[model samples]
Target chain A: MVMDTKQPFEKLVELHGATVLRVCRAVVGPGEADDVWQETFLSALRAYPELPADANHEAWLVTIAHRRSLDSVRAAGRRAMPVGEMPDGRSPLGNPGPDGDGVWDQVARLPDKQRRVIAYRYLADLPFADIAGILGGTPAAARRSAADGLKKLRTLMAETPPQGGTP
Target chain B: MTSTDRTSRTGPVDLAFAPHLTAIEPGALHRLRSALAETATREGVLDIAYRIVDSPVGQLLLAATDRGLVRVAYEREDHDAVLQQLAERLSPRILEAPARLGSAAAQLDEYFAGRRRGFDVPLDLSLSAGFRRTVIQHLEGIPFGVTESYTEVARAVGNPKAVRAVGTACATNPLPVVVPCHRVLRSDGSLGGYIGGLEAKSALLALEAAP
Candidate 1:
């Protein structure tokens, strides 16, 4: 494709911005998702001119988003907590808001590999082959991880009944 | 990649995750977009910034570079095609950042309302060059409500035999109303060709002519 024939970067953001944000929130938690989202696109903008016109824009953006989420998670680990006392409850990766349905909180409880598999497959709608590439595993293994994650979620949801439901 | 039985079992997960997928807050997205635009500008990656504004003629597309306002296209020109041409001609790093073109839009608004005579916004005349550029530069000197013949403009630009060339420049003027292309007329005192079409030419002339 001709160099000048490329669509503006704004169109890319408009098309995939929300999906990338969802991926970021699911991967790094909502608290740091915005920061990661901004970083992902800023990096993308820096490289957008060189991206091939035939490239899969959504997958390419998801890949960038995945890397940014990892960076956010690592940075969050290195930051010193200001709280004097630590809570006795499990230190889930994300904050399960007071009013939220707590499905996300259960997702936060999932093992890292399973959490990432679910996020990439379900949230980003990426194929297992793509997920395997992102997570460094075989397509079958990625599929197994997704199944395991869903199975565990179902068990967890069953054990903890939906809050504020009908009597 | 899976069988029907497996899909049925795993299908519930998709539904459960659907709500979280769309958890975007409009306010947060707006803030993120604004912040991203600012950072792009600061980093000098923003090549062309554009926005649309309503006018008596129609909605006008205003585009600017870091130097100054570059292009002002009327609705009849097909804004999308114009933008595509801009992307091909300029860099592809374009954004719909209204703030960068705010001053230009305001000045145009003032001019359209008949409160302002001359445009004070800095212009990027890169789209026009050579004779066309010289013709537009001279057109700016014709004053707010005055008219000039294409023949007279040709002579003014030191090319007495270039009357047709002067008309071509006015017809291809990238910044129409701002460059005052509507002020140029045929030798018979009739309106000549305008890039924004005849109705817009009439509208602009009438706006300038009104008391």
Candidate 2:
């Protein structure tokens, strides 16, 4: 019956892990998302003691995730290996309509800034300002990138209209 | 509009991946935590490792210091509060990584399933000291399916007059089941106060006595 407050970082993983993993997968693709996810938490654990106690934890995690995902991309670049194959419309894991258009592939193919903005804003539900903070730009710039990314995604989906429910 | 709210007007740019976004393999987080614990241990910074395990009574909060399994608590103990106690009495650098408690968890599993008679996990007794520490240590020798009177436990530890203190020790045993504190009974052979409630004490005794 002893009362206490838990400051363990474990709660953070239970809370924001899905969002962070989603951002990683959306930004870097599933092939590398798990590694980026690992790196993000590892970095968070190392620096957790130094983080401001009142800091917005979700934003802090996204910030770490953004930086870690970029590190993974940069490391991949140094190796110059071809990225993994995009999900074909027929992925067993993907909910495909009559014509599965590989929506994940389309998201991956967007311009880098647009992909980052969309993932930061939508997947992680971070504010444009926080996304700006992580990706280094003004809030307006992040918003514009998200809008542009959505415009392109809407156009692409118009042609095929990603049918069927979630996989 | 808030920057996050404005994104909603952008026609669900994340819609295409919403399903995937909502789901992450539980294993992914587990693996990440395992790796994190490993790196922190290798770097000599991991102070406490813990995981939740279901027992005959209910979900238990099993925590370990770098030294050994330090705390095992029942759900009624308020896992969050127990974690907080662990953070305070132990260290703030605590994490929930089941891999670190695999052996202890397995031993508990076997105990609940009625296949194991004893726990093999190393224990960190830093949480208890003085008479409480002595009483808790004596509890480990009580043996499975056997009950010892609190007065007897106090006597075993050279403090026969500290019967009430022995009862208090059994009530506050941080590593209750693993330390076999439930095996300690009142002088009248009745269940005494259990941090997890008398019902839990009865349940544990019943589980151990099961054929």
Cα-based RMSD of the predictions, in order? 5.6, 6.6
> Which model scores highest in TM-score?
1
- For the record, the alpha-carbon RMSD of candidate 2 to the native fold, in angstroms, is 6.6
lDDT of 1: 0.80
Q: Backbone collision count in every prediction?
A: 0, 0
Candidate 2 segments whose C-alpha is farther than 4 A from its true place:
A1-6, A81-101, A155-167, B1-11, B16-46, B92-95, B109-117, B143-147, B155-161, B203-211
Model 1 chain B lDDT-worst window of ten: B1-10
Cα displacement (Å) at residue A153, model 2: 3.7
> What lDDT is reached at residue A55 by model 1?
84
How high is the lDDT of residue B138 in model 2?
A: 83
Show where candidate 1 strays beyond 4 Å. Answer: A1-4, A80-92, A161-167, B1-18
TM-score of each: 0.86, 0.77
lDDT at B150 for candidate 2? 82
Give every collision pair in model 1: none
**Positional deviation of B141 in candidate 1, in angstroms?**
3.1
| DockQ per candidate | 0.37, 0.28
User: lDDT per residue, candidate 1, A18-131, as tens digits?
Assistant: 767777877777877888998899888888879887788878888888888777766665574545433423334565633655666777777777877887887777889999
